[model samples]
Target: MAKIGFIGMGNMGKAILQGALKEFPKTDFVFCAKTEATKLRVHEKTGIDYADSNAECANRCKYLILAIKPQFYEEVLNAVRYMLTPDHVIISLAPGRTIDQLKLNLGNDKRIVRVMPNTPAMIGEGMTGISCRKEEFTDEELDVLTRIFSSCGKAEYIEERLMDAVVCASGSSPAFVYMFIEALADGAVRCGMPRKQAYIFAAQAVKGAASMVLETGEHPGVLKDQVCSPAGTTIAGVAALEETGFRNAVLKGCEAVYKKCIEI
Candidate 1:
């Protein structure tokens, strides 16, 4: 639907590119990679074109997504600055870059979109937060992006200011969740369950609980209450978790992640 250029082809970049390509087969695609071998891999995998530099892609693509790490944005943008024009749509998945900073660095002539997405996107179950300072984009822009993210799960349009918290709640929480799952499975093994089976059971239980919250549209507390009968095993487990400051620990973990994102 549109000529899209991705400036990095790492994990997130490849995931998004493949998802978008599947959604819009006719969408012109180009990419820049750090190595020729990496570019060849992308070509073999998706049959997408390659660009000599970010500036080359910026000059040709209607939507240019910067999929590199935030720390490298300045280096990349500075190199590609002259190729950008008022006609291009710039999007970045990097957290530290803001509309004001982008405008200052890339010139006020271009339109801007910013997104923060988590690793879950690799499985088509990602939660993405999107925002744009641009006054308008063509129908093609909305169509391709909506399909690109929808292919990987869900996306929500929110104020840019909330992106830091989005990073806290969804973007970084997956790693915490994985750690929790591993700990639960290890505890199961300690209690005599097979290690592999324990992991399977623990993971499925987490999936079921999360699905209940989503499908039932009920507060997690209500669903949790339904499971925890008075003085029962579930309640006992809940008591132990509460005693360990589970909730406070979770908040503090998220806070620490947010601070790290800011530091980035």
Candidate 2:
């Protein structure tokens, strides 16, 4: 039997599988999809096995990961409900689906973990937020789960109550970051730089700035201050951004995402 099973083979699912394969090449994986074409495509891409149905996949693996859309959660869970047991650790990727809601679908005692993973998992630099009840998982189990997620990128355990915030801060922030990068590149293009080169510069700058924050363990504000020397070009740009309410815009964007997550 496979050690892990994925009920959906979507982009995020594929990304997680890619990361896991890198760390556990010998571990077997089984995936289930709604169609034969998808199964064949995923097999060709990852060289992993496929199951005929959700229950078959769930039964074949100790770790069951539900990567399907939130709207389909009920149907998928019901399909595999009979196969879920105490030994199975169900990991959910859908945002806004709380552990309580998942337990309602399965049993109240089902072992479940809720995770919020961003799109960067595709490149192995994703940030994921995980939440689970202490009673549902042992330390070793949690560590194993963390390893699976950290294989793609960083994984941190967070309180379930703060999950909506995580969705805003990490899950949906990548889109906002990409927008910022595009805007930066557009500014460079306006200054006569080639579009492709502008994108390269803007993207690398963002990546390096983020790395500095992580590696240096310094506050972002302090780092920003360092870049904004007296009467310098960076300070001038910062002042322009402040005048245009750049920080406020980012805060509002995050608020909007958090609101939508709550609604979901």
Candidate 3:
């Protein structure tokens, strides 16, 4: 079993830990947060060990996970780079940090993987996009991480170049989807339905719709067509969305996110 060490225990970091724990029951794990308070909270909840320092955790584990915020990458790299060697496989969950950037920070001679994971990883239904341009992760490593992540949600090895778009489409879009769901529920409540019941219906409808698309293996447009019987309520709603440029808004949002990633 692989020894996995998590270096940060923030939101997504916590989600990753939860996902890993649920997915890989046999893998031994250790983790350290930047502060004692977070460590204590995690320990109280999960009964996991808290390493004294990042370097101590990195040195002790064969697989190291860097779950820090983008702002602290440099500091953490400075603290733990010495502990990272060729034998260690490091996964970075920070956005906009390219594999090249990670290599430069850690060292020229190290194995690194960059992963773009969404917030839903908490519920084991997250979508994660991974890439390692420099380190050719073997089938075993790929399978290992895939299985580990599958326990949390779905993961795929994407091209580094596509990561920016992936971040826009999957990583950051959850916020957009949430807002849409909230608005849908609000509309329902305005129409006299109770707020909580509206939320339950709206959330489940969205979930069921997504599941239909996945299970039917059909294009979204085709699945949407199946729902819009000629001149029906669904068609009217879709027409309203089109008139309001719903697709265009999503495209522009993705464009903005992609540009921001490039700037970062």
Candidate 4:
């Protein structure tokens, strides 16, 4: 039996699995994809085993990641709930599936951990937010969970009440960041830069700026001020962005994500 099992080999599932593979032995991981071909392909690519069904995965593994969509939670949990044991730790990546709801599905005794991790896990730069009752998980179990997530990126445990905010802030913010990068590239292209070079320039700038925020611990506003001199070109661009409601647009996008998260 593997130590970690993924029931759905979707994008997010594969991301987390790949990240874990870097930290754990391949033999310690197993997954069940939607089809035999996919299972075989993933097994071939990653050298990880595959279970024939969700129940088999649950029966064989101690830690299970239910990587399926939130809508499928009830169906999948119903299929394997009986296979779950007291020692089994079920990790959920979907938003709005609270610990109480999972407990209702898998019985009150089962341990459930809710996680919100972004797609950037694919590149070892993901940000993950985990939520669970401290009393429910022992120090060793929490440490294991933290290590698993931190293998790919940063992980923090927060109150469940803040999970919806995390869903918008990190889980869905990547899309917004990508859009901003695309806009930056488009502006560069309009100024006669080649599309390919424009993308590289735009992406690297965004990456550098993000690194500065993380490494320097400076306020973003202060960073902006540092870049903008008296009546400088950067200040003019910032004024244009403010005039066109760039910040408000990002806020609205985050609001939409938060609404949909609770709706799910």
Candidate achieving the largest lDDT: 2
lDDT of 2 by residue, 61-140 (tens): 98898989888888999999999998889999988888898888899878889999988999999999999997778887
Stretches of candidate 4 exceeding 4 Å from the true structure: none
Query: Relative to the unseen true structure, what is the C-alpha lDDT of residue 200 in candidate 1, on a scale of 0 to 100?
Result: 99
Better of 1 and 2 by lDDT: 2
Q: What lDDT tens digits, residue by residue, belong to model 4 across residues 103-190?
A: 9878999999999999998899999999988898889889889988888888999999999999888999999999999999999999
Residue-pair clashes per prediction, in order, are: 0, 0, 1, 0
TM-score of each: 0.95, 0.97, 0.95, 0.98
Q: List the global CA lDDT of all models.
A: 0.84, 0.91, 0.86, 0.91
Better of 2 and 3 by TM-score: 2
Candidate 2 all-Cα RMSD: 1.1
Cα displacement (angstroms), candidate 1, residue 150, comes to 1.8
Write down the lDDT that model 1 would get. Answer: 0.84
Estimate the overall C-alpha local distance difference test score of candidate 4: 0.91
Q: Which portions of model 2 show Cα errors greater than 4 Å? A: none
Decoy 2 TM-score against native: 0.97
- Residue 239 of model 3 has an lDDT of 93
